[model samples]
Target: MSTFPTSLTCTSLSFAWPDGTAVFDDLQVAFGPGRTGLVGVNGSGKSTLLKLIAGELTPADGTVRVAVEVGYLPQNVTLDTALRVDEALGVAATRAALHAIEAGDATEEHFDVVGDDWDVEERTLATLGELGLGHIDLDRTVGEVSGGESVLLRLAALLLRRPDALLLDEPTNNLDLYARRRLYAAVEAWSGIMVVVSHDRELLDLVDQIADLHDGRITTYGGNFTAYEEALAVAQEAAERMVRVAESDVRRQKRELIESQTKQARTDRKGRQLAASGSHGKALMDAMRRRAEETAGRNKHLHEGRLDDARRRLSEAEETVRVDEEIRIDLPSTAVPYGRIVLTVEDLEIAYGTGASRALTIGGPERIALTGRNGAGKTTLLRTIAGDLPPVAGRAEVHVPMRFLPQRLDVLDDTLTVAENVARFAPRATNNVIRARLARFLFKGARADQRADTLSGGERFRASLAALMLADPAPQLLLLDEPTNNLDMASVRQLTAALASYEGALIVVSHDMPFLESLGITRRLHLEGGELKEIDREAVGYPS
Candidate 1:
């Protein structure tokens, strides 16, 4: 490892929206050399903060200082379609210059540029090869590759630069289980300071620290996600208890003040009686009565001040606890009676040529997880079940109301408002009902009126799920393709919690093993070379 000054500092940094609504204010933190896992729910400004660190977006207030060069791998990127893998790594002009210099016919300018560093190109190629793409054609255009491969290609290029720090955002989202494991190994071997924003618990366990973001604030922990969660749970419960005690104290103080007022009123009535009786007696009684009233008033004010102080402290505690607490909504699925043989696939074959092998077969609620390397037919088999794409030659039938959430959230209408998309997809529900359901999903008030395209990745995912779940006739079968790709940790937890209680059949095509295991997956279907094999949990990542 190189002796690099890797540090990031932010002081009094604030950011707000166009309407002057602050997302965060006076936030300060210093990130040193370590693997950090960033956690937050939807609309919590996790992604926005990452963007600030990457220098893609500037803070509205204060400043951020970084002393080292940073290499950022964005969650989604646009690549030039015509560029080949090798040329894209160094750009076309750089490759051309290098080639000329290698031919020994270069001017002083070219010689100076390529002097002694021409071999860096070989190192770049070696890095790509280490990422398990050694056999890939370097001259192949990026457009011809799968989206997963394209993502890996960009990461390979970024890693070859070998900057002082690395920022990866959801890098393992769309890969299969094998590829995800491979990525985990790659990250483990990385020697630079790294900050990763992801929902994968398994990945978070490898981090040196975990930073949780909520309500525009950040809290740092020294351990993994599991430790952070445990601490948060305990802290939330303690705060709740403290709040209850504070409320009780306020009520007690109010009662005492009321009793003291009643006593003072009785004393004044007696003094008035004495005043009506005589002259000298009236003067003495007036002095006593005034003293009593003054004393009571002072006591009342003191008690009121004490009550206010208690309330302020309690509110602060509540605010601290709110950051750790989650708002859970129970989505009640309609009771769809399980029919005999809801889905059946026999001798399913997905191959490019006529003489290809079989891929998959199913008969019931198997809770299948399609696993393989990057070019495998995991998505193709799921599409065949959804009837969007036909199998090469196989009998696949799904009888229930099957709902599919594709790799991209294409089910949502971009131009329509969130409420409008819900109404369009779930037409049987009335406007009021649809809005109420959306509100439960945290898309209430002005947010429901925002266009779907304007929402963040987490919000869009929640809206799509709301539409599907709120439909009058809920689907009995769910087919998800990389469903947790862009969701933050909290949102993923919310989903996993809801789906755990779901009585419907789920067929998930995801590399997230922890998520699948949490759902109590009964079997795993491994696909490779157009062949499907049913395996136990041990082969996937766990064992009975």
Candidate 2:
């Protein structure tokens, strides 16, 4: 095996926006050889931390230490316009050559200075071949390639350079199951330090360690996500047990206090009655008074102590309650009836241009998920159903009310405000009702009036959903295409929850495995060659 570098480390590393709103603080973690998974809710700074480690961004506080060279794959990448696959790889190879020359292994004069650099061409082609793209059309423009292919091309470029450590952010987002498996196998075989930022829980099992980021802090676990989740469950249960014990203690203390107060009242009453009878009664009253005072003093002291202890116990219970709150989930209401069949595709055929046969087809009130490679006709099938594109062959039918929320959310006018978008969809809804609905979706007050273009990806998703929900009868069948693409963890969870309970039939095309799982998807339509086939849930694994 090749000698590996020491692990990557961070010391008191912190980051925040320029405005000083803290996102993370006093964080420390060490990652070494073997696969390490970075897991966290959205907006927990997972992506930001990865960027900092890759030196793509500077930390606001402390330091990021790299024990060896690092190879980074960003979560989102835009390949240069009009560049051919081979040409793009050529550029990557040239940079690698420069790095070699800078290290004193080669001289610039040894090769031709300008275009068509022979050594760089050879090196780039070899790297591309290793990535299973050796037979691809080298001259094909990147603009014509699918998103998944673009991601692979970027990785191929990085692989050509061969850094010792790798930092991948959502590396499987754009990939299909086949490509994902291939990448997972490759990473498992590599003997180097790797830190992967991913939401796919199934992917987490491939890791040797797991780190969970929540509320600006990180907790490291010795096992993968499944183990971490099991540990978390155990901890939550233990905390709840402790809370119950403390609550019981408080109730017992209160009961004791009440009994002691009652006994004191009786002693005082008896002493008063004895004093009312004179002489012998007076003597009795004096003794009774002394005894009552002694009892009262003891009771007061004991009750005070118990109160103090109870307060302390209550404080501890509050902490446990806070931990429980971290796991809460919120899904929106699609609030509609089973209604009638919304979409029907009979002999529906989808293909790329004239590339052979149909990718998929279905009919009835089917809650189908179309999944395949980037170039495969997943989205095409959805578009054909949504009327965005004409089906290449076969027939399609639409019945009940329907709405389309494309990944880009093109349904809303960019120049319009959130309220305007909602109003447009529900023409009968009053202005006040429109605003109220937007607020429920988290676009409140002034945010509801902001231009569609100004909203963040999550905000836009919610806005789009609000508009869809406002449809008088509600969309009986909803078509979503990669709806969770750029959403933060919180938003993804919220969206997933809403979809899980949505009453209408849904036909979704997504690459997000975790999102699909959260929605309780039990079946999938695996599109390949030119047909639709049902696959068991276990047969198609998605990241958690």
TM-score of each candidate structure, all chains considered together: 0.84, 0.75
Clash-forming residue pairs, model 2: 42-489, 200-543, 200-544, 201-543, 201-544, 202-544
TM-score of 2: 0.75
Candidate 1 local lDDT, 438-541, one digit each (tens): 88788878778878876667777888888777765677788888878877766678788888777777788777767777777877876666666677666537
Question: Residue 380 of model 2: what lDDT?
Answer: 71
Model 2, span 1-544: residue lDDT tens = 2254446888899887543546668988777787889877544677788888899878888888887888888877679859977666556445455556657766654333423554565676676665656656667788777777777888877776567888888777667766677677766766777888876666778888888777777778888878988987887788888888888888888888888889889878877766776645666667878888988999978986997798698778767653412112233344444434455566666656523233333333457676777767667767777888887777667776778888557788988888998888789889987777667676668768778865544456678878887767677678888877656555677677667667667888887766776776645876666566667767647321
Identify the leading candidate in terms of TM-score. Answer: 1
Best by lDDT: 1
